[model samples]
Each structure stands twice: as structure tokens, then as C-alpha cells.
Target: MTALFDVILPVFLVVGFGYLVCWRKWLTEVAVDGVMRFAQNFALPVLLFSAIARLDLGANYNPLLLLAFYCGAILSFLLGVALARYWLKRPIEDAIAIGFVCLFSNSLLLGVPITERAYGAEALVGNFTIISIHSPLLYTFGITAMEFARAQGQNLPLGRVALRALSGVLHTPLVIGILCGFAMNLMGLAGLVMPDGFWAAVTMMSSAALPAALFGLGGILYRYRPEGEMRAIALCCFGSLLLHPAVTFGLGKLFALSIAEMRSAVVTAAMPPGVNAYLFAALYGVAKRVSASAVLVATGLSILTVWFWLGALP
Candidate 1:
């Protein structure tokens, strides 16, 4: 279908290219690590700041739509936790990881680019707003879940853990970028002009971020496979591909969104599991197996899911 060609095919191309590079040893773990570090540290921050700084905070933004999106994410996360705990009977740590995989989508790298392609630049403001809120949830609640799992046999300083988690959220580059953008917007000082040369340089660097992040993701996926964790991975893929998007579509109607806003919300909900889920899992010593599996399954499944959603869009 035309939708498959336009929206889904491009994602596969990027991911497939990375897979080939990794398979051929063109990108090693070291190279992937370096690229990821660069993305997290520099390129992503620049992209976020630039996008948010230019956005008009006073514009006709729909707060209710944003609220609905967050509610959907929270419910999805809870559902994932319940399924993992009761149905799968997974260990506490693994359940937490599974819940995160089901809920925490790659909204920054994959979501932004895909939504822009589907809905255009105006939708980015809403998309970024969602990311800003969602990032903290992924970092804090996700980490706490893992900690709870890890501390099952031992004791943990719950108060200290909460404070540390909050600190981590405050210090994250993405959070910092969002804060700076908000401050700039609030002060109405983002209108300060930059030289053409400066603008060109930032544009060049910002452009490289998306492709590099995608390629890094592809390489990571190439290096890892779900292997024996197929069942857990399948559940996550289904949640991301089917359940989350369906809920988002239903909620969008309740919000009385315009066609474009509804499309943006649906596409965002359909995004694959986020790279951050893996990072948090690894950091917290939780279900590393499921985390790795999630990356592989989510990336592969997104091709079909995105195609279907785009096709059904009016």
C-alpha cells in the first residue's frame, strides 16, 4: 500500500541499513557506544532546545489532549505490570522491565521523525510536550520499579532511592533542554536572532542526530536478539503495536481533537519501545534479557504496525 511505502518503508530502510552494517562488522560495539553517548550528551540536547525554543508557547495548544495522552501511558504501564506479574508470573525485576518495555516508547528518536513525516512540523510541539513529561516517568518510576525488583531479598533505602531518582531526572540532558526551552519561551526571549552562520552550523549538527540515533539503535538491535525471551517480547510488541495505539485513538475522540492532532497522537502511541528502557534496565540491574528482547521485537514489529496505522488514517 502507499502508506506502507511512504511511512513504514523508510523506517525499515534505516533499521535494515544499520543491521547490515552491524552484521558486516562495519559498526562495532565501541562505535555504537560512542554514537549513543554523543546523541545523549550533545546532539539530542541541541535538537530538543532548537525545536522547543522556536515553538510559541502561547499558541492554541491543547492541554487536554496532552493530559489524555499521559493518562493512556499510565494506564498502559499499569496494564503491562499486571500482565507481567499475574499472567506471566515473571520475577519482580523482570516484570518491571516488561512493563517499561510495553509502555516507554522511543518517542524521541523514532517518534519525532515518524510523526513529522506523518503529521508535519506543527504536531512536533505536542509531541515534544509529551516527551518532556514522559521522560521523567520513564526515568523515575521505571527505575523505582527495577529497584523494587532488585531489592526483593535485601533492604533498600526507599527515601534515598526516591531522592536519587529525582536527582537523576533533574540532571538528565533531555530534562535540562526541556527546562531551558520552557524558560526561554516563558521569557519571550527566544526571539533573539542568531547569525545565519550560527543557524547553519546548528542545523547541520541537528540534522545528523536523527540518523545517527537511528543507526545506533539498529546496531544495538543487531548485536542483541530476544532469543529465549520470545514470549515476553511478544507481549511487549503486541502492547506497543496494538493496545497502546487503540487506546490512544479512542482517547483522542474523547478529547475532540482535529484530524491532524488525532493522527499525531495515534502515530506517537504506535511507536516502538524506547532505547531508554534498555538503558534504565541495564542501569538498575533488572531484567536485562527482557530489555534486550524488547529492543529487537519492538523495532521489527514497528514496521508492520506503523504501516497499518498510516494506512487507516484519513
Candidate 2:
């Protein structure tokens, strides 16, 4: 309990501060959006690039751990799609957007900080390992599914659809950051070829990513109210908070992951849907309400669920 509070509450408090600022109108909506733009477009990409550039692939890229975490994530995405599309009767496009909310966890904002606080900074290699491919992989999967669904209605050729989807995924800032990092890592001799000043500048930008993201997320949440979509919201919360982590936990056990690996995978899997969920929905102009509400509600629910997972993880 104390440990959980110590690890989790501070992070929420930053989010709450952002919320309070927005609610009180202390900051203009434009200002909030500007902050978010900076965070998502600039700071976060730099952060990812820096982290991945520095990551030791051989030391941290555990195949089993990746399998456990990502399998759970993909499973949650599939289940979310089924629930939203079939049970909830959302349109296929809307279902894919909602499923993306389940697919993309708050890995950087919530997962990294919470894991660092709970376990220690040394345990973050696994978290970074997962994060390295997370956005690129999931966004590719989501975009391909979404584009093919749209193509069915538009009578577009499969080649064009595939090309369009690939174009969309490659154009995203996060994916660009990951690709650049991989390029640097592979070609630059694991980032050793970079000058100290270059890394220093990257570090400077990286420092602003999380706080700006959280604050901007709070401001965005202020705009999205939970009007209808109650069932969908509940489904999203269930998929993100409970289902994802449970799958990861089971897989970690089956894989015989170490305590640190289990902790990183399960804790990260337990995070709420990130602000990117809303962004993704907004990008497609589908299920924006459900995705935003899921990000807000699941984040609130995670305060307890995360504690439960913390206790439950061995």
C-alpha cells in the first residue's frame, strides 16, 4: 500500500495538476494543445530516439519477455475489436480505433515511471526493450487493419491500400523516432559514433516529453466527456486494465520469466490506454469519444488495478 502509493500517486498527481489547471482555466486550451504538440511531435520522439540509441540490444532484448508482453497486447486488441464490433455494434472502423485504444498502453508516461519507482532504474531495460518496437509494431498492425476495412467500402485496390497503410505508419513521428534510433544503433556502432553534444541536445529534449505529455493529456481529457458509450468505455477499461495484464502475467509464468522481467511486463501491460489512443481515433475520425473516455476512465481505474498487480506480481 505504502509502496504502491509511493510509486503511483505522484504520477497521478502530475496528471491531476494538469486537470485542475485545465478545469480552472488557468491555462488556455490553445496553450495546452501547444504543449501537447511539442511533447508528442518533438520531445517524445527525441526521447525514444535517445533511449533506443543507447539501449544494449544483446543485454536487454529478451525474446520470451517480448513474446509475453506483446502477445497479451495483441490479444487484448483482438478482444476489444470483437467486443466493440460484434457486441457493441460499432462500425468496423470505429471498432478498429477502439481496439487500438486497447493495443497502445501508456508505456512511456505511466509504465516507465511506475516501474522505475517500484523496482528501480536498473529494471527499465525490459520496459525500454518493449517500448522500442511498441508504437511501430502496433500502429502498423492497426493501420493495416483500418485501411483494409476502409478499402472494402471504397473499392480501392489491395496494392494501393497496402501502400497507403505503410505510408501512414512510416509517417508517424513515433515510428520515425524508432526507425532513426534503429538506424543509429545499427550503423553508428550502437550510438558510440554520436558526439557528446548531440546526445546532450537529445537528452535536453527528452527531459520534457513525459511531463508535457501528461499535462497535455489532462487538458485533452477535459474536452472529452463520457456522454454515451458507457458499455464501450467499460469494455475498454476491462481490456486495458485487467485483461492485458492478466494475459501477460499468465504468459510470463509459462515462459518462466525472472522476477524483474515479470514485473516489467505485467506492470507495463497494466497501464491505461495512452493519449495516443485518442490521437489514433482522432486521426481516423472514428470512435474518438470511446477512445478518449477509455483513456480517462482506464487511467482512473488503474490507480487501484496497478496496486493489485503490484501486490500480485511475484
Measured by TM-score, the strongest candidate is: 2
Each candidate structure's TM-score, on Cα atoms with residue i matched to residue i, is 0.90, 0.95
* TM-score of candidate 1 versus the correct structure, residues matched by position: 0.90
Clashing pairs in 1: none
Q: How does each model score on lDDT? A: 0.76, 0.89
Report the Cα lDDT for residue 178, model 1. 72
Cα error, candidate 2, residue 213 (Å): 1.6
User: How well is each residue in 172-239 modelled by candidate 1, as lDDT tens digits?
Assistant: 88878777766756655635665779658778878888888887777778867766567777888877
Per-residue lDDT of model 2, residues 76-141, tens digit only: 999999989999999999999989988899998889889988989898888989999888788888
**Model 1 off-target regions past 4 Å?**
147-159, 189-198
